[model samples]
Target: MAAWNLYRHRNSDGSSKDWAVRSNSDGSITTRRGKTADSLPGVSNRYGVKQFDIERQKQAKGYVLVGEVDIDVNGNVVFPGKTSATPTQLPEPDANPMSVPAPPVEALYWTVDCHAKQTIRVELGIEVRRLIGVIQSVSDQQSKPEQDWDGWQQFIDATLNAETFELSGQIKSVHGVLPWLFLLALKAKSFKGVEIDIATETARDLSVDLKAEQDVLVFFGTDLDSIRDTAEVLGLLKPRLNLAATMSDTDDCWF
Candidate 1:
């Protein structure tokens, strides 16, 4: 019963917050939340399906599963690589302390499940593959495109063609495509960083700034309601969209 699921949300300003959840011996779930390094107090208790629902809610809000720790019966949190005897409280900083360094950003894997009967999954796969193809074409003119071309090709061959595929890299490395995809689903302003003029059929520089993380899973199901649920959790799709709308009327792209 010592297991805990730790989650962290990195802010745009380089700060981060933490959330932790663990199941108690009585089959109830407890959760904690606070800024990184703060001793967060247990904030809530949940049971059964509600526990999972809460977890998904946190994920949708951009909290990524960073790591896990152990909480002893005495309410002591035991972090990995630390001695059990160590005090949980961190020591105070000096009066004239230097700026604390930000933690190293870890590369995250983006996974999309394409093994479904719905055509939306296949459409999503095709869209992603098309983007990769464009990347390949652009890189072909560069001095060192062969390596990158081969790598992206492997991604398509390994995962997109099969049931599930995972793409691993920093968010910036993918040219911020995750957020762009989310924005496209919204259909409010832009597509692929371009402002669309429906009347003119032209594109311009996008005005909105989209944000997303590398660690997430995207799955397209049989209906918009299910897809919207998953997207809302990932913070890709907003809640204002009519859940009753079908895929035919909306943009199709996952992750």
Candidate 2:
């Protein structure tokens, strides 16, 4: 590993001073500015040089953090950290060019609205029309004490006119045991691969086990890749289609 030592003048202010990396072999600085190598060697180009500045720095060489990085090696290009391999010689291309695999295409992600198509009707006592075990948000999260089943009917009248549905993770003020049973009725009707009998609302949480079914795909909110994969498998999106689209989409909002 060839190296250089930069320096600034012995008598100078810290800011405006000459600096250069002295070739380790020649003892002469390889880089120079205005007044030549006057020895202002505070910071070094590589990480090791910075350490040298801190421990055994000479007054002639002070250090400064600069915009550019300097790698003193010569000839074939050398990557940082790894010192052995030279990038100039690449692995020989496959004799049959067609044998080489193509770069994978981008993935496409699409939001599914199957729940929106499904709705609830109170005409037959708040029965679900489509998917039997679908969870629906009550118009009010907290069922009022004074508000009885009659009030629930009134709530049904005022809200739920639109086809809006609920995501699995929302809970309002406080829900009582009876409301839980109301929601769990769907689970009773839809014992599709569901084995546990949900006697209470708390049981509803564990009644549906996605892992028990071999053909079901369940993704946690954090599992963005699996969700995208499930969407693709269901024909909701094409293979390798990423909604982020741009290479610069660094946000974890999708996750």
Candidate 3:
């Protein structure tokens, strides 16, 4: 019945934290010292045996249980056919506290699922693509007299403004357009409910993932006049990319 006597780290005031337990090739169990984590056993005899009076012995010294694992009767720390659960052993900190590595940052991400409103999304996508094409065509056909970039840009902006101009567009619409509708409303003078419900949800989820390292501002419009951003612009936010997705499909695309 030999097993690991897990011990967690706690503050002097008895608050608990996620410090790793210490185990060795031998059946012995111990814990690291206060304030340091992922380190080797700093305090000796911290882990107490469950089968004997060892639990009382360690508790007397203020050790807390974290978890446990079964050991073999041979007393050679029989690792139960499981992958190594040992936490990574951290090296001693440098004399300069700042020299120590910063704790790993949990990646923040945001997910926008528009599967429910695929019909509207595809429609919007088609219109947006068409408008984008018109803009590009106008820009490239500078030598042509028929090109009308300004008119085309205004048309797209007006279209986007009419169909889905603000955050309420998503909330008020049949389906949730979310970031699509919400981001547009930002250009408005003043609006409400942006920070509530879906908006706050997006923030709490930390789903702001993008290929670029800098912040991205995605604008859904028809023209590129004010598109080429300044120092404030990190990158243009694009639509949700699907693998092998077509540029435009009669059934899939709206325009």
Candidate 4:
């Protein structure tokens, strides 16, 4: 909140210059003693959070778009405003040609990361699948026809081959224990892919709901000492259990 090394260069005529710079406590440089600060307005870091709210921003900042699909002619599947589809069947020298309109279809795969220790709520949009079809004309110069089944098959192939997505968020809390443990659980789990759903419905506008369910463990402790003690006992017991050797003693085993 302090300004540093403010200066005004004076000419021999004793006129003052109009610029200044300031150093911020967070190791960030900022302009202070100049018209820039006054003209720009809202130049204070006072509204910023004291620490990073990892959970609050996790879902808000992360999303992965997997792939794109193209729409074919049953009609033009124009995004907003576009014209109608053209005829696919070609004209003949001796007979009339049949025409059909083509429609557009596509789906995009996405991964959303929710950043929060407390639960978050959100509204998700609809999910769609792409239709696959090839372009081929009876003659090389004619318009091509498409089939519904083929298009569906193409969508399947594209979605299946879509790349895997991983999303992470930084959350800040006075106590870092819960956050650290949650991260460790993610590392221990093995999943081909995961679907996460977290929500926070109340305080709609003021609070950003950032919550997600994952394949890994999610533990938040009001009582960390108890859980830590239990983990130590279990850790010691696991390696000592070898039941197969005890049961298979061939020398003189009588059970």
Worst 10 residues of 3 by lDDT: 166-175
1-255: candidate 2 lDDT, tens digit per residue? 343333334234433443444333332223433222222224323211222222122331333322222333342212245443222221222335455453331211111011222233232223433221222333234234332332234324333564332212111113222232333344444422222122111111222332332122211112334434433333333578456665447564466
Candidate 4, residue 228: lDDT = 47
Query: Which model scores highest in lDDT?
Result: 1
lDDT of 1: 0.44
User: Candidate 4 lDDT (Cα, whole model)?
Assistant: 0.25
Local accuracy by lDDT, each model: 0.44, 0.29, 0.33, 0.25
lDDT of 3 by residue, 116-221 (tens): 2435544554544443554444445333323222323433453453332211112212111223222332212122221211222112221223222122222122
Q: Order the candidates by TM-score, highest first — what do you get? A: 1, 2, 3, 4
- C-alpha root-mean-square deviation, candidate 4: 28.0
lDDT (Cα, tens digit) per residue for candidate 1, span 90-200: 322243657865344222222222234335445555654655555445445534411222234444564354343322121222332333333333334222322211100
Q: Candidate 1 — which pairs collide?
A: 60-233
lDDT (C-alpha) at residue 130 in model 2: 27
Backbone clash count for every predicted candidate, in the order shown: 1, 21, 4, 23
Query: What is the Cα-based lDDT of residue 178 in candidate 3?
Result: 25
Superior by TM-score: candidate 1 or candidate 3: 1
Candidate 4 least-lDDT 10 residues: 123-132
Cα-based TM-score, every candidate? 0.32, 0.19, 0.18, 0.17
RMSD of each: 16.6, 27.5, 21.8, 28.0
